[model samples]
Target: MLDMQRRKAMQKLALLGGGMALFPTLDAQAKMLEKDVPKWDEEYDAIVVGSGYAGTAAMLSMMDRGLKNVLMIDKMQYMGGNSSISGGSYAMSRTSIQKENGVMDDPEMHIKDTLKSGHNLNNPEMVRIMAYEGLDAFNWLVENGVKWKLFSRSGGHSAPRNHSVGVGSYITRPLQEQIIKRGGQQRTRIIMDELVYNDKGIVMGMKVREKYEFKFDRTFDENDNKTGKVKYYRANAGVIIATGGWAADPKVRQIFNPALTPDMPTTNHYGATGYTIEKLIKDDIDLIDMQYIQIMHVTSADEDSFGFGFRTITGGYSYGMMINPKTGRRFINEIADRRICSDAIFAMNEKGKNHPLLIMDVNGAKTVEIDALQRGIEAGAVYQFETLDEMITKFNVNKEAFLDELKKYNAYVKTGKDPEFGRTFFKYKDEYITIEKPPFFVTRPGPKIHHCMGGVRTTVDCEVFNKTGKIVEGLYACGEVTGGRHGYNRLGSNSVVDCIVFGRRAGFAIAERYQKMVRS
Candidate 1:
């Protein structure tokens, strides 16, 4: 029966052109075939197919480079795609914050840390650009009225250079406000529920369904089918695809990595589906590293409230430890980078049976903000216990084994050594806090589909490439839409910087091309 269904799906994909096989069902293909070719409703110098940090940065950079007419569109009703839902931390080096905090960091250090975290599979040129240009991008955010709360350390970085701005809105909101303030609102039009494309293997324009609503039902086959009045907007200069990754689509995720079944939860927004990628693939764009899907280690398993979304646990691995519920012992270093921790949890699952538990004391809880912890507790995503005994009894963990594990960890903390996993305490180092205080907190944090380290391959200049390694004219990509920046695994906080740095590159490149065309 499953084979029959698979055959039918393949046939339907063939009918609609094989590139779109990743769509939910054949109903979407039928809708596409039935839709009329829309007449151009408007034209612009450049059309950006997302409103996240990448798209916003691209549009703003184009405007700064004297390109007045640009259109930014998103399939969702609001702007700030997955970027707005992010932890609002950007990895940068040698910034004012780093200097103020008395931390010694530079782009060279950033580059080394990034390459090491990514296992050196990253493009050397792209890594250098992102690392070196990060400080400038940080200043750009500040110049545009975005403020950083402080500088802190994340898992992969060697220094306390992850600049935080509360949530993603701290940066996205300011960018939006600045766009509106600069009389660019007229030139910078944002149409919602629009999916742009390349026409006949060349950059052109987009097709949109205005005012369409997104039904949260994932099982609905016709969710992405065009419903409202369809319109097309033409672009004279080029089209920039910053439409993010395929983490949200189970079908596409499984197509890339078979182990990532539909049962796995994801931290991506609903719009993170790879519709744009499918469209680009149809245009002959090359996709690389599709199997390198990165999972985030902090996510809730509760399906009712904030399901699949991350809880803002402030202290991270520095203040807590991850324990195997079955053995009631620390199995992996909680402070390791996301991939290491996530892979460890996956390996320990033992035929996909159990999830690891992250436990912390009051001091660790204090590292996280009170409001965030309260929100998690109210949502029933986090649990608090008055004592170790209460926690052990509540979770049905082996009390003796759990206590022994905690005791062993505390001893290691006293000596500033994680002998078992070699967990580096980058921020606290010798002053690392012990998980001994009462009123302990615990949450089951499993891996969630987080990032795709692959997409339409691109050059360091943000120009998309074809399978033959030739540049696709008038087509640009950035952010998660482009591949080869962070080879196998992405370092924490580097994603935001990647979006901004390459976003500017794409913007400037497109603007320069547009000006040359005008001059000719």
Candidate 2:
């Protein structure tokens, strides 16, 4: 039924400004008029939206401080936005990695990596707070259930302080479980349409509507079918926007970035839309670095799927090797910093007309399907072909050129060497592997521009800022919505670290605000 309505809505969508615009059709307008929006007259001490690492941390922290009236909200039926998809890596200081290895890393270096990575575009204050306070947050996550194992730092970083929570940010399940166990109120699959405003220009509550939610069936067919009424959550205490970046918003991406205009490569959740953020900006909310976007280097075997098990970040090997189609050869080292890798991928895609070529083993081809494919195949994220020749044909590469590329790669595989690019000897741990197996897999890589490094400008304590960089009263934001942590590109797993450490701080901070306001 919901699918029917969505299809109808799509049909009723009109083409305007060269894009499919979903303005209210006459039917929608009439339906909206027929129904009264839910009145959110009750004010809560605190309200936190989004269930990712940041949201969960904030929610849990608020409860810890006896802010029982708080409510946690999310648009997805399931909690944990990008946190669920994340690899759960955390950047910290004075940790076992540093202590055991005697690696001398301080907040200065972390701040430097963030600042230099962002090209100094990040907020210095927020960056400083993040770097200095990261160790505690990293510890908090491990205490909560986020397990840590040593993952070779993929991008450019000074030390081995990079720690992953075994599952990355996907531990949302456990975090949510903890939050629920604490008796915190959780409302999932409800879209936060808008923030309620008071006459004094302070935040009130929020207008929410139960929209599409994630329905997990082994069948895997779930959606937002409930044409529910809009509700409200009063923010008499504080409102925290934990909603993540806008990777799922296609139109917005097209408008802001031309390279991701079509089929380039991006790994974002289906629900990371910045709808609330857009509305907030329209309502005069301040933002930081809205223009600085981050792109990732993705390698998939086919046009349909994205390759995972990042050999650069993880030592996992897949069927094919990544290449720069323009040079018709491997270019920058895959283990190079993410910024360089992203630049190389975008340049190659733009130059090669978006058809990246891959070379893999015929035996490795077998690894391309089934459990090896995992969620990719079930989610239509990848496509498989029988032979390297067939895979080349699908990608529209020069057959002879593709064969020649494979010949050279195979020679290197037999010899334990890649002389052309020196990729095998790259610093990242996974560069040395042999894909001499059958059923070589090929996939189209998509850059995950999900976590916006730029968001509502905020202080380290997580206070939302105005355009003049002044703190907005009665409001705070953290997680992806409050950016300025990662300078340009966030190191893998670092964002989750920032979210939890800072999210806990935001919770305590907001709870204190509520207490002060109550006292006053």
Q: What do the candidate models score in CA lDDT, each in turn?
A: 0.75, 0.62
In candidate 1, position 203 carries an lDDT of: 56
Q: Candidate 2: where are CA atoms >4 Å away?
A: 1-42, 97-106, 166-170, 211-226, 262-265, 299-322, 325-328, 350-448
- Give lDDT: candidate 1, residue 51: 81
For model 2, residues 107-198, the per-residue Cα lDDT tens digits are 88877776666555456666677777777777666677666655444465656666765454446776777777877788877777666656
Local error of candidate 2 at residue 190 (angstroms)? 2.3
The best candidate by TM-score is 1
On residues 406-520, what C-alpha lDDT tens digit does candidate 1 reach at each position? Answer: 8988888778788898876533533567888878878777678899987878888899887678887778999998888886689889999999999999999999999999999
On lDDT, the leading prediction is 1
Q: How far off is residue 193 in model 2, in Å?
A: 2.1
Instruction: Give the TM-score (vs. native) of candidate 2.
Output: 0.73
